[model samples]
Target chain A: MSTLNLTAKAREAATSGDYSELISLVPYAKMIGIECIKLGDELVFRLPAQDGNIGNPTLPAIHGGVIAGFMEHAAQLHLIAAMGGQHLPKIIDFSIDYLRAGLYRDTYAQCQVWRQGRRVANVAINAWQTGQAEPIATARAHFKVD
Target chain B: MSETTIRPRAERFLSVLKHCQNLGMTVEQADSQGLILRLPYSDSIVGDPETGVVHGGAITSLMDTTCGISTVCVLPEFEICPTLDLRIDYMHPAAPGKAIYGFAECYRVTPNVIFTRGVAYQDDRDNPIAHVVGTFMRMGKVTQSEALTKAVNEGRA
Candidate 1:
């Protein structure tokens, strides 16, 4: 498999954001193997199999908490990129739209910074199965960048 | 004659669901889309005093487990299936005193891929507490006989 292009510094910056800290309080993402990569204006992440968000006999069906965890991750990555600094400005709120289902195998997320402001940056993201066209979900988040 | 086959992983899963059912979790519906697991709001489970509503984590557990079951229904041979991703939107706070049910459905099913979506509602689907979508990894399953054999060796079923 080709390696995904992202810097360790950018990733570390994202993993250390306040949004990441707040949600990590829950065990959902850690259990699912969620990972994020920041590339300039773009942010990518993987939703790994196995999580506490939800349980199922088939295993492909995941819980909502897992998704929320990634959303926060992507948002923070953008915050870090926009600020070009260690500390994230702030996150006012985040929201998502559920477009479809993702198999337990693995799903990918692509996030774009729509508007970056000194104080607030708006971000939009689309998540879907690796090989499919239709997005599993779309999300937009607002954050404050110092 | 061959020895009896049993799937310890599946059996162990059932015990967990049975506990939820005993607590009044209604994971009793299945349709063409997939399994529809429900969790009803009741006083015993809703320990929070302020709203008397079911806990978010408990509801998440229901969604997670049902998503897995939805995958299991399609592939009856896998020993395990894990979650890939899940997205849930809390449209409204859960009502503490009312019996709210979360209906989970698996939408996409492949040999190694599974997808599902579900929602939480108060009896009727017209009103819902949350919208949930999930992705699962079809880990793999073992047949009943294989399960029994594994149990014989592993000492835990």
Candidate 2:
């Protein structure tokens, strides 16, 4: 398939909210069990509680790295979804702050594109397990999007 | 303090962490210098199938785990330290089919927090795939989970 045709199809998949097709392109996201769902006009990503994703079995907390990875991927996917798959994002840098322990539960994340120029895009992501007001983690990522 | 003593403890620590186990991480070295961890390349970790490159998140996980554990080298006793904040810069994508190594050192340890800096590289430490600086909050000494402890004991037996 031509690269153009492939991107067109990916754009279609994203625009129509065929999240599985979009997610299948990245294997790590699938391996870690990330899913995307649309509520109203916003997209929300979820990481369901899994034994293999735990870090401290004592508190039964989700791994900090897992939380970071999830937020980062969520931001990337959101960027793709937002741009209608016109551009692929390569992460330049990412900074994340952990506000609270991510307990072992279904985690949800939402991303907003803070700014997007021609070559770079900045995204802010927030992840929460129980309540959105009390976020477990918040992150900012810069992606080179051409 | 001693490699012989800390090696087994580190190995046992890695085995119980489900995420570390899932990523197939192994301790290459653990001593006063810091911690060096190996993340074996696998299909499950491939981020871009087109280029056969590993995901950035996998690198983040490896560095995070390495930095978090580096606290053990500085502290007198085991404590439950959680990541406070972390910043990672992706210099480049790791080569496909090559295992990535993460080396982290606890540079500063305050009463309330531990500071760390690390690099993820393949083959050459001079050329890093990514670099990370992180801070972790120092919680009190670990309290073993009964269920996890039982599982570990049963597996050993």
- Write the residue-wise lDDT of candidate 1 on A3-115 in tens digits: 32223344455455323432232233343455665445355677766443333323235544345446655566556655554553334445555566555657788777899
- Kindly list the per-residue Cα lDDT of model 2 for residues A19-96, writing each as its tens digit: 777677678988888999998888999999988889877778998899999999999889988898897788999999
Q: Tell me how many clashing residue pairs each candidate has.
A: 36, 0
Q: Give the Å error, residue A145, model 2.
A: 0.2
Which runs of model 1 end up more than 4 angstroms from their true locations? A1-146, B1-12, B17-23, B42-48, B76-79, B142-157
Error of 1 at B64 (Å): 0.8
Residue A141 shift from truth in candidate 2, angstroms: 0.5
Query: Model 2, range B16-71, lDDT digits (tens) per residue?
Result: 78899999999999988888999999999887766778988889899999998887
Q: Evaluate model 2: give its lDDT.
A: 0.86
TM-scores of the candidates, chain A only:
0.68, 0.93
In candidate 2, position A19 carries an lDDT of 77
